[model samples]
Target: MQQYDVYIERQKRKRQRLIRRLVLFSLITLIVLGSMAGYHLQQRAVYAEKVEEYEQLEDTLADLEHEELLLEEEIELLQNEDYILDIARTNYFFSKEGELIFKIPDESPSY
Candidate 1:
């Protein structure tokens, strides 16, 4: 009978040790998973911010391209002799020889 009692006591100790090991492993796994989740969220936020910045830069580039096209058009217009003559005559009061130069005040208020 005493031998049987000793055998039962050893089996109980072994079962308790097994349970403790399982619990410890579960806790470690939980901690690792939690940290991974946090890191993933942080990286996602940074990616979103970068995407927003990239979109803004793209919009600015489009605006600059449009402005460049307008400037090119203006440069082409300025190369025309008719446009240059018009600007010189209107702004600088230039005219052909024997042409009367009239200095009349504008009816509308000048800003």
Candidate 2:
């Protein structure tokens, strides 16, 4: 009876050790999975921020293109000979020799 009692005690110890090992492995697996999930979430956040930045840049480029078109049209107008002489006379107050120049001031923004 004593020998049987000793055998049962040893079996109980073995089962407890096995249970402890399984619990430790389960905890480690959970930690690794959690870490991987956190890393992926961080990556997604950074990607989203980059996409937003690129979208803002795209909008700025579109506005610049519109401004460029207006400037190009203005340049075409300025290429005309009469328009050039008018701008020179009005803005610079320049006149040809012996020509009657009109002095009329206007409220406008300068170039």
Among these predictions, the greatest TM-score belongs to: 1
lDDT (10s digit) by residue, model 2, range 1-111: 999999999999999999999999999999999999999999999999999999999999999999999999999998898899888988898897798877767879688
At residue 74, candidate 1 shows an lDDT of: 92
lDDT of 1 by residue, 1-111 (tens): 999999999999999999999999999999999999999999999999999999999999999999999999999999999999999999999997899889988899978
TM-score of 1: 0.79
Q: CA lDDT of each candidate? A: 0.97, 0.95
| Candidate 1 wrong stretches, greater than 4 Å | 108-111
Tell me the spans in candidate 2 whose CA falls farther than 4 Å from its real position. 95-99, 104-111
Q: What TM-scores do the predictions have? A: 0.79, 0.70
lDDT score of residue 42 within candidate 1:
100
Q: List the residue pairs that clash in candidate 1.
A: none
